[model samples]
Target: MLSTKTLFARTVQTTARRALGTTTTRGKHTVPDLDYDYNELEPVISAKIMQLHHDKHHATYVANLNVAEEKLHEAQAKGDVAAQVALQPAINFNGGGHVNHTIFWKNLIGEKNGGGQLHDGVLKSAIENKYGSLDKLQQVVNGKTAGIFGSGWGWLTVNPSGQLDVVTTANQDMPSNIGHIPLLGVDAWEHAYYLDYNNVKADYFKNIWRVINWKDVARRYDEAMSKF
Candidate 1:
């Protein structure tokens, strides 16, 4: 039988390969199928919200990214510097949207599953070292994420110093856009939890921890630290 670490290592390998587009076809970006059903993350995240967030919102980002990339290709071919410059925002917004959601899905699990559990591992140790305990870090992240005045994402990222940090990015901006490797991310946009939590963003932030896939996070942390 595989050890827990080995199994998680395999999961990380598969997830990383897919996220990097190594296993996907070139050209267009695509919406990935969740490992479980949309209803799997229930109570913490409703099926209606997941359905709309993934199938609708995320899918739209993928479509828009493909469109932007296609137009970008045309602009580059024609040496249209002005057009290319104008298209940068679209590419970044939609591309970041696609990237962010991809990580976001991998960051969650069903409540009955691994979600909400921060098992003993490198990630736990790192979190403890950074913020004293898992609970403390979660509070910090939730507070900062809740404080965002507009749509954005809250991320637990591996910083350049090989340390963990909780950071918030406005809009669809990715952590990688600023040289951080996002291990876990929570979408703070209204569409993510408005149907269930309404305008109470704090409740959504607090409840989201119940579905966090800490195994995926630890695996990601392991990989990121390996580079240091």
Candidate 2:
């Protein structure tokens, strides 16, 4: 058998190689491609708005997330807790942006499909149980979205107890971090609807429902239920 010291040296070298490989593998983050084309949800969301939101706004978030992660790694390597804490906001903002947009893109569907209808299932039951009916849930969510003073998100979330809720967060804060699993999220930022709806955010919220991918929301509800 090899001497203990020699074996330890070899193990250290192997670990170093793995670490170096991981560092070298870090690469530019790419924007996720949409499953549907712009204009696919026309009449609810305009093609021009979709293109700009995905190509310009969401891309910026992905790029910034990469930069923030790199800075976080640098701070961690230096053992600088203060620097790490200072970078937390950058991490949260960009990370939340990246995450929320990723879900938002998939949560929409083409008008050709039965986009907004929620058929009978766990999702329907959950909504009925929590809000008395789907209409009530929508009313609460829309009202909350309208009440937001500035850019933020309105969400339907499932708590650990399997109860559904409507909650709004300022800016890009995610509901998951606060112990709720997001079932559906509506982006209320001016950029999300300004091109099509202008200053009428409530109108946008109400109209956008026509293209909501209830299939995705149902799947999320099912998955959340399974985890319990």
TM-score of each: 0.88, 0.86
Local distance difference test, each candidate: 0.83, 0.79
Model 1 steric clash total: 0
lDDT of 2 by residue, 1-228 (tens): 986545544443333223222231223556799999998899899899999999999999878867866775676566555666666676567767877888789888976887888899988987888789878888999999999988999998888677788888889887776768887899999999998888888899898788889999999888888888
Off by over 4 Å in 1: 1-26
Q: Which number leads on lDDT?
A: 1
> Tens-digit lDDT track for model 1 on 27-137?
557899998898999998999999999999999988877776677567656756566666667766777788899989999999899789998888898899889998999
Scanning candidate 1 in windows of ten residues, the lowest lDDT window is 17-26
